[model samples]
Target: MVKTLSRANYPDLPFYPERMIQFGEGNFMRAFVEWQLQQMNKQGLFKGSTVLIKPRNQGMGPRLDQQDYLYTVLINGIMQQQLVNDREIITSVSRLINPYTQYDDFLRLAENDELEFITSNTTEAGIAYDPDDRLDNGPQKSFPGKLTALLYRRFELGKKGFTIIPCELIDRNGEKLKEIVCCFAHEWNLGESFLKWLDEDNIFCCSLVDRIVPGYPHDKATELEQELGYEDKYMVMAEPFLLWVIEGPEWLKERLPLAKAGLNVRVTQDMTPYRERKVHLLNGPHTAMVPLGLLAGLETVEEVMTDPSFSRFVNLLIENELIPMLDLASEELRSYASAVQERFNNPSIRHELTSIFLNSISKFKTRLLPVMQRYHQEKGQWPELMTLSFAALLLSYRGDRLQRQDSPEVLAIFDEAWSDQGTVAQSILSNSNLWGEDLTQLPGLVESLEANLRQLEVVGSRAALEHRIGVM
Candidate 1:
C-alpha cells in the first residue's frame, strides 16, 4: 500500500503564516510561484505561506486540499547545456478556497493583517471586464469582480492594501487589471473614497512569467510514486529554466526578497527591455522556425537545430535577420541567441513543430512581422528567410500537409485567397486585418514572397533551403 502525502503522515513538516493570497490553484502556481516561495522560506529570506483561491468554479483546489497542499515539483530539462533532474516537495501553499463555494471565507481572508501580497495567473483572458458581475452576488463570476468585492471588504475594516503582481501574459497586465477593477467600482457606485483607496493603496505590478509546467506526469506517476515512497496525485513536471520579470519599484524587491533566495527573478522599474528581449529573441525565432521547419519536413524543434541546413537557417535568421533589426545591445542579443539555440536543442524537450505552427498568421504578425518591417526600414530590404517563412506560412494554410489549427474565420479567408493562386500572394499580404497593416505597401515584399513561393513550389522546402544556404 502507498502512503498518502499529508501533515499527519509526514509529521515533520514546517508551517508558516498565510501572508499571500494567490489566485489560480493550477500547476503554474504550484510549480513556479509556490516553488519560489518555498525556496525563499528555506533560505530564511521570507517566512510566509500562500492561501490559494480558485479563479473559476472548477479547479484542483479540492484535490490539493486532499493532499494537505503537499505536492512534488519535478524539474527535468537543460540548464547551461547540462542535464538537470530534480524534485522537491513544495509546502508553501497553506490551504485553498473556491470563491463560488466559500464566498464568505474568501472575502474574510482580506481582513487578515498578515496578508501583504496577492499573485495571480488567471491567464490572459481571465483579466477581462465582465460588466454583468455584481458585488452583492454570492460570488462574482469574474476574477476582477471577486477581487473588487474583497478589496472593499478590506477597506471597510481600514486595512492595508495588497501589492498585486499579476502573471497574466498580456501587455501591461497590472494596468489592465486595475482599469477593470476601477470600472467595476464605478459601476457599483463604490464612491470616490474607494476609488482613491484603490489607486493609492494598491500596487499593481505587471509581470512576465516564462516556464513550461507540464502538470501531472501520468505516464511516469507509478514509477515516481514508487521512488518517493508516497502517493502524490498533484505531482507537476516543469522545465529547469525559469524567469519572472516583475515591473515595480526597487522597494518591492526588498518586500518580496526573491533575490535573497537566489532565484532568477528581476524586480525592475521598467520591464520594457526585458520584455522586448523575450519577444524578439525567444518568441520571434520560435515562430519563424515553425512554418519553415514544417515545410522542410521537420517533426520537432530539436530536429530543426540538429539538421545542418535548418541549423544554419536559424543562425542566419537570428544573427543576421532578427538581431540586427533590434535596438538592444548586440552582445546581449548574441548571448541570448546562443542560449536560445541550446534550449531549442534540449534533448529532454520534444517540442512538436505542428503545435507551434498553430495560429501561425497571428504569431507571425506579432513576432516576425515587426522584425521584417524594422529590417526594411533600416537596411532597405526585407529579410530573406523570414520572407520565405511567411511564404511557407501561406502555403501551410492551404489545407495541405500541416493540421490547420487556427480560427475558422482565418481558415475561411485563406481558403478564399488560395482559390486564385495567380494573385494569392497579393491578396493575403494586402489584408490589413490579419497583419494590422498593409504589408503589400512594404517595398519588394510581394515580389520576394512571390519568388520564394515559386521556389518552394518548383524545387521544394529542402532544396530551397540548400539553395538559400549556397547563396548566403
Candidate 2:
C-alpha cells in the first residue's frame, strides 16, 4: 500500500530551526527557494528552516501541515546538453501558518530571534495598496497588510528586523512592496517610531528570479507515486535552470551563504542587467510567441521550442533582432538566451501558451517595444522578426483565437484597430498615446505589420512563419 509522505514514514531526517518567514507558500517557493535551502543545509552554509504564511485562504495550509510541511520537487530540464530528470524531498520548511485562520500564530512568528529573512511570490497582483485595510482586522485581506501587522508585532516585541526579498514580476519589486508597507504605516497610524524602524532596520532587496515551476504534477502523480512508493499531493515540477539575482547591500553576501553552496544565487550591487535580461530575452519571447504559437495550434512551450521552423524563428529573433540593441554584453545575452531555449524545451513542465497570453498588450510594451524601437534607431532599419511579432501582438488582441485576459481599455483599442474600415494598421500605428510614437513613420514597419497580419489571416501562423524563415 502506498503511504503519505510525512516524517512518520521517515524518522531519521533532521529538522532545523525556522529562520526564514516566507510569506507565500506556493510551488514557486517550494521548488525554487526552499530547494536551494535544502542544498544549503547539506553544506552547513545555512541551517535554517522556513515558516510559511499562506498568502490567501487557498486551503493548502491544512494539507501541508499534515505532511509535516514536506513536499518533493522534481527537476526536469537540460544541463550541459544532457537531459536531467531528478527528484528530492524538501524539508527546509518547518511549519505552515495560515494568517486567514491562524492569525495569532502568524503574528507569533515575529517573536523568533532566528527569523532573519522574508521572501514572497504572491503573484503580480498581490503587492498593492488597499486603502480599506485596517490594522485591527484579524488578518488583513492584502498581502502587505498582513505583512505590516506582522512587522508591527515584531516592533512591539523588540525583535530584529528582516531582510525581505519579493519575487513579484514587477520592476523594483522590493522597493514597490516597501512603498506599500510604508503607506500602510501611515494609514494605520502605527506611529512615527514604527516608520523610522521600517526605514532604518529592514533591508529590502530588489531581486530577479527565473525558474519555470509548473506546479503540482497532477497528471503524472500516480506514476510518480508508484515509482517513489509514497503519495505526494504537493509535488512540484520545475526546470533545472535556476537564477536568483538580488540587489542589496554587500553585507547580504556574507549573511546568505547560498553562494557557498555553489548554487546559482547572486547577491549583487546592481540587478539592472539581470532584470533587463529576463524582461527582454525570456519574457519578450514569451509575449511575442503567445498569439503566434497559440494560433499555430501549439499547446505548450516544449512543443513550440522543438518544432523546427518555430524554434529557428525564436532563436533568430532573440539573437539577431532583440539583443543587438541591449547594452549588456553580447556573450552574456547569448548565454542567457541559450538557457532560455533549454528551459523552453524542458519536457516535464507544460508551459501553456494561453497562460502567457494574459495581458499581452502591456507585456508587449514592457518586454518587446523598447528593443524594437532601439534596434530601429541604432541600426537604421526595423528588426523584422520582432516587428512581425508586433503584428502578432496586435492581431492577438482581437480575442478571437486565444483566451484573452486584458483591461477593457486594451480590448476597446484592439476593437477600434479591427473595426476601422479605412486603414486598420495605420489607425493603430498612428495612435501615439498607445505606442508613444507614430510607428507609421518608421520605414516599412507599417507595411510590414500590415503584410504579416494579412498573411496570418490567409495562411495561418505556421505557414506564415515558415515562409518568413526565408525572408529574415
Candidate 3:
C-alpha cells in the first residue's frame, strides 16, 4: 500500500483557529498570503486559519476541495550563496466556500465572531460599481457588491468588524475598494445605521504585496512529485523572496504577528516609501527592459542579464534615467536595484518577456511615462534611456522581422495610429492617446524619442541601443 501523506506526517505543524475570510482562491493569494499565515502559525505568532471564498465561478475551487484544502508551495531562489529548494504543505486554508453556490454558508461566515480579517486579490478590474448589484441580488455582480451585502448581514447580526486588506495592484487599492463598497451600500439604501457601523467598526487597510508566484508548473510535475514524495494537485511554485506591507493602525499588528514570525511583513501607517521603491525600482525597470531585452535576441530574464552588453544597458537604464527621477536615497535605490538585477539573473525561474508584455500601452503610461515627464520637468532635458525605451517599445510593436511574432494588442494601436502618416516617428510621438498628453508640448521629449525611434527602425534594436550608449 502507498503511504499516503497526512497531517501526521507533519507533526511539527500547528493547528490554528480559522479567523480570516479570503475572497479569492487564486494561486498568488494562496502561495503568498496563506503561505505567510502558515509560517506565522508554525512560529506560534499567529493562531488564525483562513476560510477561502471563491469570488469567481471558474477557479481552483474544485481542485482545492479535492486536495482537502491543502496545497504544496515550492520556494526556489538564491539564499546565502546556495540554491535553496524548500517545500511546505500549506494547511492554513481550513475550508473553501463558493458563495455563488453556497450562499447560506457564505452569509453565515460573516456572523462568525472569530473572523476578524478579510482579504482579496480580485484583480484590478474586479472592484467596480455595478448599478444593477442590489443588496437582495443573490450572488452580486461585483466584488464590492458581494462584500457590501456580507458586511450588512454581519452588521445586522451584531456589530462585527474585520480588517479589510485588499491586494489589488492599484493606487490606494483599499481606499478605492472601501469607496465602492460604501457607494453600493448607500445606493442599495441598506440604511444609515449600517453606514455608521461601516464607518465606526470596519478598518480598510491598503497593502503592498510582492511575490512572483508562477502557479503549478505542470511541465515539471513529474520531477516535483518525486521530490515532494506526494501528489499535490494544487502545488504552486514561487521565488524565495516575499514582501507584504500593510498600511493600517498599530493595534492590528498586535494580532497579525507576521513580524514576530521573522517574515518580511510590515504593518505601517505610511506605505508611500515602500510603494515608491517597488514601483520605480522593480516594476519600472521590468517594464523598460522587456521590449529592449526581447528585441536584443534574448528569450528569458537570465539570458538578458547574463549578456554583458544588454546587462550593462539595463543597469545604465536604471541608474541613469530612472533613478535620477526618484526622490529615494541613492544607496538604498542602488541596493534594491542590485537585488532586482540578481533576481532577474536567477537561473531557476524562467520569467519570459512575452509574459511581461501584457497591455504595454497602459504599462508604459503607469510605469515609464511618469519618469519621462519628471525627468523632463526637473532636468529640462530628456533622458536618453527613457527615450530609447519608448523607441524600443514602439519598434517592438512593428512586428519582429526575424521571428515573425506580432507584438501585443496595445502595440497594434501604435501601428494603426502611424499607418497613414508620412513621418511615422513624429506621428506616433504626437499621439495624445498613446502618450497620455501631447508629447509635442514637451520641449525635447518628442524630438529625442522620435530621433531614437527612427534610429531603431533603421539600425535595429541592438545597434540603436549601442548608439545611445555611445558604443556604436
Candidate 4:
C-alpha cells in the first residue's frame, strides 16, 4: 500500500523563514519558480521559503497543504542532444493561504519582517484594472486589488515594501501590475505618502518565464506511485528546458543567484532581446505550426517535428523567414531556434496540436503578425511559408475537422466567412477586428493567402508542405 506523501513520513526536510509571497498555487508555479527556489535552498545560496496564496477563490491549496507543501517535479525532454528523465522532491514552499477564506491571515503576512519578494503567475487577464474592486473588501476580486490592499496594510504597519516580480505572460508584466496597483490606490483615496512609498521603496521587475508544464501526470500516477512507495497528487511533469529572465537592476542578482546555481535565470537591465527572441522563434512557430500540423492530420508536436516534409517546412519558416526579421545576433537566434526545434521534437512531451489551437487567432496576432508585417515592409513580399500557415489557420477554423475553442464572436465570424456566399480568405483579411488592423492593407498578402488557400484545398496540408519543402 502506498502512503500519502507528507512531512510526517519525511521529517528531515530543511526549514527556512518565509521571505517570499507567491500569488499563484498552480502547477506552473510548483514546477518553475518554487522549484528554482528549492534549488537555491539546496545549494545554500538562498535560505528563504515561499508562502503561496491562492490568487482566486479556488485553487489547489488544500491538497498541497495535505501533502505538507511537498510535491514532485518530473522533468522529461531532450537536453544537449540526450534524453533526460529526472524528478526532484520540492520543499521550498512553507505553506499556502487561501486569501478568500483566510483574508486576515493573508494580510498578517504583509506585516512579516522577513517578507521581501512577491511573485505571481496569474494569467494575462489577471493583471487588469477592475473598477468593481474596493479597498475594504475581504478579498478583492482582482489580483491587483488584492495586492493593493496588502501593500496598504504593510504601509499602515510601517513595514518595508516588497520587490514584486510578476510572472504573467504579458509583455512588461511588472509595469502593468504596478499601473493597476497605483490605480487602486488613487481610486481608494490612499494618500500621497503611500504612493511615494510604493514608487520609492518597492521594486517592480518585469520577468519572462519559459517552460511547458503539463501539470499532474494522471496517466502515469499509478506506476509512479508504485515506484516511489508514496502518492503525490500534485506531481507535475514538464519539459527539461527552463528560462527566467528578470528585467531589473544588476544588484537584484545577489538576492536571486539562480544563475550562480547553474540555472538559466538571467537578470538584466533590458530583457527585450530575450523576450523578442522567445516570442518570434519559440511561441510564433508553435502558433503557426498548430493549424498547419492539425490540417495535415498530425495530432501532436512530436508527429509534426518528426515528419520529414512538415519538419523541413517549419525549419525553413524559422530560418528563411522569421529569423531574418528579428533584431538579435544571428548565431544566438539560430542557437535558440535550434533548441526550440529540439524541444518540439521531444518524444516524452505529447503536445496536442489542438490544445495549442486554443486562442490561436489572437496568438497569431501577437506572435506572428508583427513579423509578417516587418517582412513585407523590408522585402516587399509576403513570406511564402508564413502565408501558407495563415491559410491553414483560416481553414482550421472552418469547424468541420477540429473542435474550435475561441470566443463565440470569433467562431461566428469564421463560420460566416467560410460560408458558400463569403470568401474565407478576403473576408477574414479585411475584418479589422480579427488581426487588429486590416491585413488586406498589406500588398500581396491577400493574393498570396488566396493562392495558398487554393493549394491547401487541392493538394492537402502534407502535399502543400512538400511543395514548400521542394522550393526551399
* Best candidate, lDDT: 4
Question: Could you tell me which 10 consecutive residues in candidate 1 have the lowest summed lDDT?
Answer: 58-67
- Residue-pair clash count for candidate 2: 0
Supply the global lDDT for candidate 1.
0.88
RMSD value for candidate 2 = 2.1
Candidates in order have lDDT scores of 0.88, 0.86, 0.81, 0.90
Candidate 1 residues 1-472, lDDT tens each? 7898888899898999999999898888789999999999998888999999989988674667888999999998778878889989898999998888889899999779999999998988999988789989859988899989999999889998999999988989999999999999999999899999998999999998888787888889999999988999999998887789999989988999998788889998888877877887888888988877887789999999899988898888888888887777899789878877877877767889888888889988988888888888988888888888888889889888778899998998899999975678899988888888888888899999989988988888878877877788
Steric overlap count per candidate: 0, 0, 0, 0
Between which residue pairs do clashes occur in model 3?
none
> 1-472, model 4: which lDDT tens digit per residue?
8999899998998788998999988999889999999889899998999999888887674788899889999998898799999888898999999888899999999779989999998888899898999998769998999999999999999988899999999999999999999999999999999999999989999999999898998889999999878999999999899999999989889988899888999898999999989998999999988988888788998898888888888899999999999988999899989989999999877888888899999999988989989998998888888888989998889998778899999999998898857567889989999887887778888888889989988999888878888987
| Range of the 10 consecutive residues with the lowest summed lDDT in candidate 3 | 400-409
TM-score of 2: 0.94
The total of clashing pairs for model 4 equals 0
- RMSD from true fold, candidate 1: 1.4
lDDT of 3 at 346: 74
Candidate 1 segments exceeding 4 Å error: none
Q: Residues 172-266, candidate 2, lDDT per residue (tens digit)? A: 99999999999999998899999999989999889999888878888888999999889888999888999999999888877888888988888
lDDT of the structure predicted as candidate 3 = 0.81
lDDT of 4: 0.90
